[model samples]
Target: MSSHHLVAVDWGTSSLRGALLDADGRVREEQSHPRGILSVKPGGFTEVFETLFGDWMRPLGTRCLISGMAGSKQGWVEAPYCPCPAGLSEVRAKVLEIEPGRISIVPGLNDSHDGVPDVMRGEEVQIFGAMALTGLRDGLFVLPGTHNKWARVKNGMVTGFRTFMTGELYSLLSQHSILARTLDTSAPLDEAAFLQGVTQSDNGQGLLHNAFGARTLALFDRMPTRELASYLSGILIGEELRTQSVHAAVDVVLIGSPALTQRYQLALQAAGTQARTLGAEATWAGLHAIHSTSHRKT
Candidate 1:
């Protein structure tokens, strides 16, 4: 009936992570599984949840908050998205309760641009968590993943945002495209090649033309086969950056795994924009913040 302890879950499309937090919001234990929403059979979410995290929920007053695609139509429970210009209050108000006072799903955020709609599920929690951890009420936040998100926050509300298939494109190009033949996709990042791609993206020759250069560059011995993947990555991420009107004066925050965020940091810095990085902790803090607020309301 009370929320003296918390279990925060970020269950995405391909993977899920859970954190057990004490009353102080510090993580006490953590678990991860590859059983994302897609892996769960229809009507089997409860079983999956109980299988993975039921032990943590046995204590009295332990509440659980699930975020990400777990709230989508295909998820355990469909938690409708809260329209943009949303903050903790707006999102908290719309959370879908699957098990009253014990388990809930945090609603995602949606925004439209020129009649084109863009949506995100779990990234919103990371944004709020970043805000709570950093004490920043306003800034530009980017969550880099398979589909990267660029969100604008004003006075603690996400006013608008955009999504780019940067990572997905990189995957396709590096693994399935013609360029894949010459690319050692498993090679570690080559900063020089990556920055080169970033610089090339700014030459005003659009992505289609520049992306082809990856193949030509390797074909002509201009770039090594091992470095082609990084070069290609730079091009895609750079292309994603081309559309943003990033101001040098504004603060930029990057949230994701260290490896991914480092790539974005390099690309952003190449364009003269500096960014701060946050990791998985943001997700836990965000869910904890929402849980605390909801507990207060009760």
Candidate 2:
């Protein structure tokens, strides 16, 4: 590892991940904390962050680059989303200010048309990293998360994208809604039930209409709660797959955790859209890409 050091963070609503990388961009050390945005409360980020990084700071003199919800309206500070076709400099200039450290915040991107708005945060870094790796000028990139995003890359820029709250809605209904009463969170992913829901979801059955099937199926005792939960999972994912305009002619890369990528790959396979796992080292990949550009420019 190079002697010089920098930090990269992917902070979300529920958890925060940070990496200490060498000047050459290899991760030397990393840490995570429960001081996610939700847990930090309003204006408590400095204290919470200090608790997480106080020890590491003794090593000293490391600059930081952050992505994800950390730049959102509710995060530590609003770094503001840059419009599409933005460059590395435009993103870098929006970095939020912090004391006692050199920290840069990567901004989100937004596009609106026909009274509908599509937005993204952490995925932009992955997209930039993917372009650097693949040398692809245009393709489809999918980032699966609480708010799954499907993006269209054109001429090495994010020309357009859409967000589907598939994971978030699943969590909401599964935990807080009546569906929770009828669904089992600890249940395994039932391939059979998953396939059934995937198939049904494709047959012109609208998502809202199909959502009722979960409870209805349970009401008649035709589906077990575990199976129902699995089916619901398949339903939302499948519906998103069916409706989205994925550019399959160019390569489609999926960036996310292994299980999420696998589940999406299975669903895309069922929908006849091919996508490959792009690895789960998003923060590292993003950090390396940013640091490389930072070096080139300097």
Candidate 3:
């Protein structure tokens, strides 16, 4: 049997994160790199890993468990997705071994709701980690990012979920679209303007019409020139919460960076909803949990 530690990875589209864990599953060291799946040359994943962790693993070769885009088709290896309402055991059973059971990739979750398929990778681990850490039996869990995810969880398992491209759209419209010219990108959010957008989402006017309001608001000087971006962002996030929160329990679990979560918490509050923010390092906790239970030979 090997005495090496476990290395947990959260390799997403734009970044790669590695954590070296001791036997007790506590992270002893952590490393992050910008070499995401999209940036790595085709079939060069091995080289990239060596560049990032070779020296760290030199002391004692570590068994690795990877999640996120690293398991997608575009990633190092395509670990097949497990169908939802899935638990960790099911996800674990499908973990793909990249090196004779030594290096493994965690499988993402897939759901077909109303014939529309959706999936999430790294978030699965974080969501389950929050579940294990908080001991919450059921609620709505949100992971805010480029593609915001809203998941329905029950009894420590993910029942179903949906994804929204609100962040991506904001970037596109704020940076490259015509609206980009009318607003200051670096301007801080105007809470009043943002809340106004949140309020507008419920006016029965649909997103299409309301999105246009970003332009109209600035055109008419209805909102401050510097605050246009914030108001726009609010509109998108506000609408996302409005539509999805209805399917959620009274209290929603909001996850992600503090800045983003705070915005969500406020939006949630405005929507007459309650949210509990989990400040733990969810992905690491999740990977640690999986590694603890796997107990596979190195």
Candidate 4:
């Protein structure tokens, strides 16, 4: 009736999102579930999908398109990752059909280069979508999330990318580590403390040592106990920037939520790098791109 209305889902470790797309690939309606692939019981991906959109979309046909952790080994069905230096066509060709072409999951990308050997599941969509939205044919993209990603594109092809577990480390240390006792998670972020942490990250004291200063500040009455969270945020983000110092020399486009992107922008400014932000819609654009590309071949 609506020309495919096929559901496009981005299932991650902690969240799941589905958007019903019209013929033109515009999102007609959207739905979200806090229960992610990890939170569900074994073999519950289909069930979760059913509970989320089974009824409303059942009559429209369940043939769907999906991406993200839904394709990981822990997800619905492991869609093997495509190699790097890949374009949208290569990525489109690798889509895994979960129900004999009824439901499909997009594979992530693998950068088999030297060093840390990077991989990205859902961020690829955002990267390509950002390119389409911002008219950036080729450049670097900073997709900030639990595991912030730095992806490179050349001539409209995703060459490679790396990962930084900035948000994960921040949450772990601030919640369960020694810094948790004195930190108030609810307190608003203190910009001065955060900036101070970023400023001091270059002292050559090392991250493990810098972390201790969070407690040292609290114990010595050096700063407000509540500001430790923001301070630690700056330290972790600043360290991430240091690790990706290469990007500091170039203009990086950040794609993520406004709050996280704003913080990254601040750190980037401190590092003397130029940056900008794209919103959550970039993923939808990327997904629609894949869908249209796939249909053209069919």
Candidate 5:
């Protein structure tokens, strides 16, 4: 591992990004492309990777660790999920080596809720990275995206987690549904309106009933069209929060983009919970940690 460099990649559905890291696990360079797995033709991953990252891999002994959809059945190569209760060591053990020591894919994690199955690909890396950065072996973590995830970790391992379609639902209701008629989707965040929706969600009427209020509020001019989008966003996110047992005494770690995390932070505050945030750096640290551990074992 002394002379070798690492190429850390996070290839998801809509885009791909990578970093060139030195032996010490510090990022030396970074780049991204809009060509995500969905955009690549079948069996064309090699071509795409080479086109986007060949220069970084040209140096001898450089290894690449790819995470996310790039390892899914629809991507370059299928890396089976590593079942939950997984830690860094468990994940490292299950990595699918595609080119011996030159490249490998980090397997995603699979968990179950009741009888329904839930899976996450790249979020596992971010969770581990958050742990590495925060020095907390156990806590609750939330990753907000198209599909928001709420994960619980104990003793440095993910015991289980749940997923919510909060973001997708917000998009649908705000853009595709009848509510879109009055929504100013491009309006900036209206904190007051958003919080109003959050509060409305806890009214015991449930989401199906609460969501419709967004349209009615706008129709009757009770709420401004410009703020309707934020209101709708709050209702969905607030519903997601309703499923969790957030305690004021406990802190939740949030890993995602600023916009999403900021919303989660505000919602959590309303629930009397504290939140800490980590961004893309968590993914890099998680990849580097696994790469370093795997190399040290050899």
Candidate 6:
């Protein structure tokens, strides 16, 4: 018998992250590449994936669990998203097949009503793990990233979620638009400007109107580009949180990279909402738990 273990992947638009986990689910080795779904040209997924996979599969025995955009339309193959209120059975049903390996792609959650669609990818698993760890059956989990997601979880299942294009929009305006030229990437966050945006834009009512402040501040030379960038980030993040934090009777779990989590934590604190940070790696832990419970093999 082969001593195969677990391999969990968080595949996204700009990068592919893989971790080799032992029987107890500890990450033994990790590998990454910028070969996300968007980076691969049409019909070239398998070739690119093999290249990335071969670089990591040194131990040669692992059960692969995948998540995120790798299951999208442009990925290696399509694994349709399971609507909200999804559970373990739903995740199991949407698993994908890979060559010579046991593989599963965590499906995104899609819920649209009144012409608004909220979607998410790899972040959900991490949220699930966080929920499992804290045993908080109901609350809001905010995963900050290129597409910030605020998810509602109840009874250990993901009830629903909404995605805000805050990070992506910031990236665009900071790089492609005129704002890009004025914003300094290295400057520190200006507390006054950030607080101003946070207090003013906390609700959706004045968000769009507040965004122009970034450009205006830049034009008047009242704020440096770097501080302006921080202020802009505060505004967008503030907008999303204000709308989502309503009726958040339960605590909020802010999950993502440390920097992002800190920013949200600070924002949530300012809004008088209780929030805490959880790392993205929790998804891998949850995947391992699911795998072990199901007795699934490599």
Q: Which model scores highest in lDDT?
A: 1
Clashing pairs in 2: none
Superposed Cα RMSD, model 3? 2.2
Q: lDDT (0-100) at residue 169 of candidate 6?
A: 86
> Ranking under lDDT, best-scoring first?
1, 5, 4, 3, 2, 6
The C-alpha TM-scores of every prediction are 0.98, 0.89, 0.93, 0.93, 0.98, 0.88
Better of 2 and 3 by lDDT: 3
Off by over 4 Å in 2: 1-3, 58-61, 87-89, 97-101, 133-135
lDDT of 5 at 6: 93
Model 4 clash number: 0
Residues 1-298 of candidate 1 have per-residue lDDT tens digits of 2358899999999999999998889999999999999999999999999999999999887889999999998899999989999999999999999999789999999999899889999999999999999888889999999999999999999998999998988888888989888989789999999999988988999999999999999888998888898988888888899899999988899999999999999998888889999999999999988988887887
Higher TM-score: candidate 2 or 6? 2
**Residues 16-133 of candidate 5: C-alpha lDDT, one tens digit per residue:** 9999998877989999889999999998999999999998998878899999999999988999999999998999999999889788999999999788999999999999999989
How much lDDT does each candidate structure score? 0.93, 0.78, 0.83, 0.84, 0.91, 0.75
RMSD of each: 1.2, 2.4, 2.2, 2.0, 1.2, 2.7
Runs with alpha carbons beyond 4 Å of true place in candidate 3: 1-4, 59-61, 245-249, 296-298
Which scores greater on lDDT, model 1 or model 6? Answer: 1
Stretches off by above 4 angstroms in model 4 are: 59-63, 113-116, 246-249
Give me the overall lDDT of model 4: 0.84
Cα lDDT, model 3, residue 201? 80
Candidate 6: tens digits of C-alpha lDDT, residues 10-56: 88888888887788777878888877789888889768766766555
Superposed Cα deviation of residue 256, candidate 5 (Å): 0.4
